[model samples]
Target chain A: MNKSIGFLGPKGTFSHEAVEGYRSGQNKAYELKEYHSIKDVLCALKDGEVDEAIVPIENSLEGAVNVTLDVLAKEEDMFIVDEFIIPVNLNLVAKQGTKAEDIKVLMSHPQPLGQCRNYLNTNFPGVVQLEENSTSKAAQKVVDGDGTCAAITSKIAAKIYGLEVLETNIQDNENNHTRFVIIARSLKAKTGADKTSIVFSTDNKPGSLYRVLDIFSLWDINMTRIESRPSKSALGQYIFFVDIDGHIEDPDVHDALTMVKRKTSFYKFLGSYPAFAGKI
Target chain B: MNKSIGFLGPKGTFSHEAVEGYRSGQNKAYELKEYHSIKDVLCALKDGEVDEAIVPIENSLEGAVNVTLDVLAKEEDMFIVDEFIIPVNLNLVAKQGTKAEDIKVLMSHPQPLGQCRNYLNTNFPGVVQLEENSTSKAAQKVVDGDGTCAAITSKIAAKIYGLEVLETNIQDNENNHTRFVIIARSLKAKTGADKTSIVFSTDNKPGSLYRVLDIFSLWDINMTRIESRPSKSALGQYIFFVDIDGHIEDPDVHDALTMVKRKTSFYKFLGSYPAFAGKI
Candidate 1:
């Protein structure tokens, strides 16, 4: 029996696209399931409802997805097995025969709406904007609603929902992209060009984080991204999420993480996975 | 002559509370104006619609309020004139005759809705939750709608909107607090106990950020907080928002930031204002 994979979806979401991308690279056919929320998608995998789960971790335009990072940090027995990057191409999509001028209400997940802020302000100023859980759900709303509604969503979502694309590349930034990760019960083997992600909180001291970063620098490791999320216990406390080049299998990477684990008050190694080298 | 202050408001939101707190500490009376969004509030200040604007900068539970930070970073001539911290006390409010059991739908701004997730999960289970622009707006919605509606809003909002408190302190964390900042056209004079906030983007190279952080460490400057936001240019590129303990008038802080500016590709000096030391 093939393993089942879970994604955040009502179908036609970017997470659904990531699932399709993952499937294309795999040798064996796998079952796919859609969970409504990112937390639900990860929890389903942990609960054995699925063997793998894919969810977005970061966007070029929107820094870190805090809920995803928070869930990954809090949950035990979860590891990233792969990584994927997808360019966010937002389109003004509506029902067939609906003109752009007729769009009185625009809808999307808050992200795409924000990504298209300039476009929306320029093209549809004063239009009522609504938020949905997913861009695909927004597309679904456009399909179900009266002719005055449109959604800023992926092309796949428009096609899947049988909506017409009224405008294309509606995002404010051409470089907009989202990075997604595949989470599993265990980590994957080293793929040479891989990245390791970890979350750790330091003692409430001035130079504590710098000391931790010094360890990576001393080991000649390259950090690709760094983000800080509030620890939720208090105002100033934070957990640092960092992605660095090299997998745990690398000798330097192994040594540096061992040092990092010992130095930090709290630490969690999220995973080591092959880095996505596609157009980001 | 009295100055005018602006805030993101519908008359009874937490921003309204922040404005009240600020007014209490002032020596002069000021005219208060309300803007619909964070950007609008800040832009109003920049556009000379108000002499100052108060906006939430960070929450103990939710971390940084990105819109406020992004707007401050992008706009010119905006400076932090003051800072205020208020404990976020969320209440479940409804019409006077409505009971907790009568609520079929709940409403609040997305932030408060998220802050009360566990509480809602335990109490309401699957109540239909709606999002409004502000908590006060949510309270107003409860007032205009049928009796079977409730809002998670501040105590002031419940009173102003003439709603009954069904439950008090519905937030998940007791430590929930939001920090608001007063932005003006000019910076405040240095107070001995002050914090300078700056946003800078380092070259996308290994050890580049570590070196910039090294400046603070070298000057013995204490950094209170550090957060990364996307540069909005590309993936893996980030602009860092840092709050350090000391005003620009402090020699060490001045020297460290001067070094930081010289080292970074892009830099912006947000402001230096007296640190809020009342409570965490």
Candidate 2:
């Protein structure tokens, strides 16, 4: 039976591309499904409408995608079972024969517009920018609208929407990449090279967080990343999302988290899964 | 002589309101100027065009404003001198005589749209949502266009744009607030009740960040908040922004920072300023 994988999409988004790339890596058959929003994808996973959901967790340029982080924090049923990194190469796509200079209005989702800020400022100095609901919608609008409009979207979108790429890698930074996480209802069996993600909030004390970090240090487990999101209960209170470079099934990791868990009022084990590095 | 303050605006933005609130608190007469973007506001400060720039640093619901954090990280000449907390009360403002049931579309900046998601979803499930460049722009568009549209903006914006407040405090969370920071070319003289903000990065070795936090614990300094933004140099690399309770001139804070400065590859003392607490 083919497994069902859900991702944020209108068929040509970066999330859709990441899902396709993940499907190819598994060497297993899967039925691809797309949701209109990040929340929709997670809700689909929770409601069993899909077996798994792949969503962008962080971007090198944009930092964390808050909606995904907040949803993962709130939805106790979902677990991150895998990770993928895709180099974000934004392209300036337009209808065929449309010259870059002739483009009076540029369009994209707010994020791409930001990532490509330097490029846009330098090239299209006085061009009007219009925000679309999604990058795919931006690409669609360029094709459906007049010749004097262009979109900053994916090359995949250019192909899917039958548009021509007027420019490639239009993003300001070459290192721009997005980290996507594969979420599922169950934890995967530990692969030797894996990472674990956990969310917890420390007690309202000065040294509470330092004490937690001390446990990781004592166990010699390397923490890959740490991000603080508001607890929403009050100002200055935060829930920390920590990624460590070992599976929970590992004895050292288990010992570290056990002690760390004891120190926090809220502790959630978000699962250990194979970690992906390098560009797609 | 009148001092000048810069803020993000098309006029009637939350940033504009924040500047007004800050001015009243200071009990001083100053000329207020509006800029097109956060960068413009900072640039105005750096160029000596404005005495100071006040911009939103973070939101209770939406994490850190990356552009503001990144700008602070990159611009060594600018410093955060003070902070203001403003409760974000999003209002559904429309042209006069527009009925809630007759509204076919809602408009706002993406941030407010997300903040008001639950309210929008429940009340106008089928209504079309539009994104404007700013919340103030959304209000202006509603007044300039058809009556069957509304905007999620501040009451100040509705009043300024000559729109009617169809619904008040329409945001999903009552506790939603934005933390705005006053940025200037020089740090403020330390107040007794003050907070210090600093940004730093540790060596890539394991336990490096833990060691830095250990120093804070050793000094008994209370860390009010901590945030990690990608250094933009590489994947998995991060620059940490930390807020601690105490003026930098405080002996304990100075001692801790002195030791911290020695340990990090990069350290920036953002500034010491009187911290604001309680609601505006």
Candidate 3:
């Protein structure tokens, strides 16, 4: 069967890169669909228009992507079947023959601009920063605009828009990477080495989350990630999205999740997939 | 003394509203200055250009503003001396005499647009969405553009920019509120009912964060908030930012914090402030 994957895209985004990387890794033929927003990507998955949706969930520099986490928490049917991490390599790109000194306006999405702040501050100094809807849009802007503009975007973005890379890997952090997750209607068959993701709201008591984490400690499961997002009910209320290093089929993992469900007011099984080791 | 406050602004943003609310609540005259971003707000505070800075730190729907959290985590001298929760009432505004039916383009900062997603999807259908640098900038865009353009922004922004309100409180969630924090160089004198905010990164051992929270449980301190941000050193490493229901002057809070500081590999004192109850 031909699998289909949906991603938040404009042909040359990091999301596109993630899907491409995943597709090549599997060496399988698949159809790729692009959506403008993370919400749309999830909606397509829920509607079964695609077999799986790959969306960014976390960045080393930017932390958790709230839209993805919130959607996962709210959407009961969707499950994360796998995860991917892509090293973000932001390039300063512009139209061909645009001199570096002539560029007065820097453009990109907020995150990439933020990640490259130090580079911008030191290099551009007082250049006017114009934020576009996306990095690809920024690259498109550079293509459309006069020689005074440059965009900090992906190499793929430059290739798509036929822009010239003035500088490569311009992000301040050399170790910057973004974590993406593959979401589907059902979980993949658990391998021995797997990671389980879940979201749960603790009982409204002091140290409720601490007590929940105690269960994982008792089971000796290593947690890979823990993020607390607002439950949207009140100011301090939070639903925890956690990824633990064990498959649901494992007895220890199953027991730990069962204990967590018993202790919390809300419990959601987000799914188990092969554990993502540092690279894609 | 002429006290001054810096905020993220283009004259009429929520940051401007926050400063206004803080100023009127104090009933003291203070010079107000506006900056383009939270980083600038913090820099002004750090450089003593402003007596303090008031920037949105968290939103009920949007979660913690990562820019604010990361800055609070990174900047050593700055402390969160106060907190304010403003109920976010996003309004659909346009030029005078412009009707809702005539509106074709909707502009605003991404967060406000996200908060009002349901309202926008239902009312506007497929209206072209525009992203501006700030909500106030969105209002300015509507003012600068044709009558068909409308902006999703604050009531204050509408008033400041002379845009007529087409609809008020357009946010999908009535409980939508943004939590703003006042940053200063030194802590305010601790009140009896106060909260202390601290950031700590645990040792990379198994169940590390759980063990740190256990100390808070042992002290019987009621924690008001807890968040984990990327330590920025690596992908999996995280720095836990915690707010507990007590003043650092209190013995229990002091002891718990002392233990937390001892347990963690890196620890930073964010500051102690009066506990925020609903309104500022």
Local distance difference test, per candidate?
0.88, 0.88, 0.87
Query: Candidate 3: deviation at residue A209, Å?
Result: 1.1
Candidate 3 is scored at a TM of 0.95
Error of 2 at B128 (Å): 4.7
Where does candidate 1 stray beyond 4 Å?
A: A99-104, A124-126, B96-105, B122-129, B147-149
At residue B227, give the lDDT of candidate 1. Answer: 94
Best by DockQ: 1
Worst 10 residues of 3 chain B by lDDT: B125-134
Ranking by DockQ: 1, 2, 3
User: How do the residues A1-280 of candidate 1 rate in per-residue lDDT, one tens digit apiece?
Assistant: 9989999898889888888887888798989999767877888998999999999999988677877898899999999888888888888899999998898888887778778877887898767666566888888878789999999888999888999988899888899888899899987888888999999999999899999999999999998888999999988899999999999989999999999999999999999998887655
- Clash-forming residue pairs, model 1: none
Provide the clashing-pair count of each candidate structure. 0, 0, 0
Tens digit of per-residue lDDT, candidate 3, span B59-125: 9987888878888888878999998878788899999999888988888887888788778878987
lDDT of 3: 0.87
Q: For candidate 1, write residues B97-216 as lDDT tens digits.
A: 898888898988778987897798789866766656688878888999999999999999999999999889989889998989999999889878899999999999999999999999
Q: Write down the C-alpha DockQ for each prediction.
A: 0.69, 0.63, 0.60
Better of 1 and 3 by DockQ: 1
> What are the per-residue Cα lDDT tens digits for candidate 3 across A66-91?
77898899888899998888899999
